[model samples]
Target chain A: MAELDEIIHQPLRLRIMAALHALPASTGLEFARLKKLTGATDGNLGAHIETLARAGYVAVDKAFVGKKPQTTVTATAAGRGAFARHVATLQEIIAGKQP
Target chain B: MIDSQQASAALNDINDVVHRVRQSRIYQNASLIIVMWGALVFVGYLANYTWPPQGYTIWAVVDLIGIAGSIAIAAFSGIGPGAGAYALRLLVAFLLFIAFGIFCSAVLGHFGPRQMLVFWPLFTMLFYALAGLWFGYAFIVIALCSSALIVTAYFYAGPALLLWMAVVHGGALILGGLWMRRI
Candidate 1:
């Protein structure tokens, strides 16, 4: 049986990863949009995103759109793989194939 | 180790977030299209009001631009593979819809200029409302509000009906598109 990813197991991080995974590969969500989707405050979302970034689960791109700074987050290939496996393991658990 | 119940809850949460993301993407693409149409119709109405005799020419130009712009947006929106097929399908659907409208207004009903003015907006809004049954509530709200204003102007705006439509129909769509982006 597979184990749940401790890094992704946190509720907010789980939500974050799920949002990124839903998009087409390499497409990123802006920080404001991600925060709105996940219902996280700026600081809280920033910290969780940092954690994901460190885990190599997501790539963060910072750029200037005109004079304004913009941040976009996308799931890396490894991140998408880990998220898929995590979900499958969860499904297995629900199906009584795991403890 | 988490139990089945805990795992189920986690999966449900994931599903919820995934749904939100999908809806957001839809809103993003739709908002652009709506805004483009709104601007086009705004100008179309003003031009029609100014050149009453050339109303047909002005509107034909406006509609052609709107359709072309919408197709361009769909193609460039990064909808992934089959985007060209999707665009072709969209153009076909639009042609069919317009054909049906022409059949109803010109061949079957013989609607006059005033009736034609109101008919097209109402007819399009009806489709928007129907699409909302699948797309989201924002479309329904925009359609309903715009239709109401158009109907009101049809009865009450007198000689200024076109101007009223420019403000109400065109402005409502522009505002609604902006609002959809926030949602």
Candidate 2:
């Protein structure tokens, strides 16, 4: 039986992961756009993103865009694999194949 | 381990976020196209107003430019290998739309200049409203508001109909495109 990923099981992190995964591969979303998509506050989102980053599930890139600091987040390959398994596990549980 | 209910809820959350992301992407891409067309329409109407006898030439040029720009935007915005095909399909659809409009206004109805002025904007808005049924509410709202304004101008503006269209029709699209980005 497969288990849910503890790192992504958190609600805000799940939302963040979902948003990033929805984009085309290698395409990252800006920090502001991620926050808007997840509806998370700055400090809260920053903390959750740090957790995912530490788990090697996401990559964060900081750069300057036209004199403004910009941060983008993308799901790593491992992250995508984990997310897919997590979703599958969730479906299995819902289908009564797992506890 | 979570129960089935909790798992279901979690999946629902993921689905919700995915839907929002898809809609957000669509809004982002569509806003740029809408703004470009809005600017072009604004200029086209102003040129038509200034040069009454050159109206046909002005509109033909505007339509050509707007279609080209729209296709370019779609091509650049699209992802992966399907972009070219998507752009081709869009071009075909646009041509078909224009062809139908010409058939109605010029061949069958023989609308005068004033009727032609109102007809095209209203007709385009009808498509926008229909697109909203599949895309989102923003298109519908923009279409309805712009159509209402165009109809109002048609009945009331009398002598300055082109100027009124330049302001309301063009102005609404610009404003709506900006607003769509915010949403």
* Candidate 1 structure quality by residue, lDDT tens digits, B59-90: 99999999999899888887678678978988
TM-score, chain B, predicted structure 2? 0.96
For candidate 2, write residues B61-135 as lDDT tens digits.
999999999899889884556778888998998999999999999999999999999999999999999989998
Which segments of model 2 are wrong by more than 4 Å?
Answer: none
User: Can you give the lDDT of residue A37 in candidate 2?
Assistant: 91
Off by over 4 Å in 1: none
RMSD of 1: 1.0
What value does the lDDT take at residue A87 in candidate 2? Answer: 97
TM-score, cand. 1 vs. native? 0.98
Candidate 1: tens digits of C-alpha lDDT, residues A1-99: 698999999999999999999988999999999999999999999999999999999999999999999999999999999999999999999899986
What DockQ does candidate 1 score? Answer: 0.87
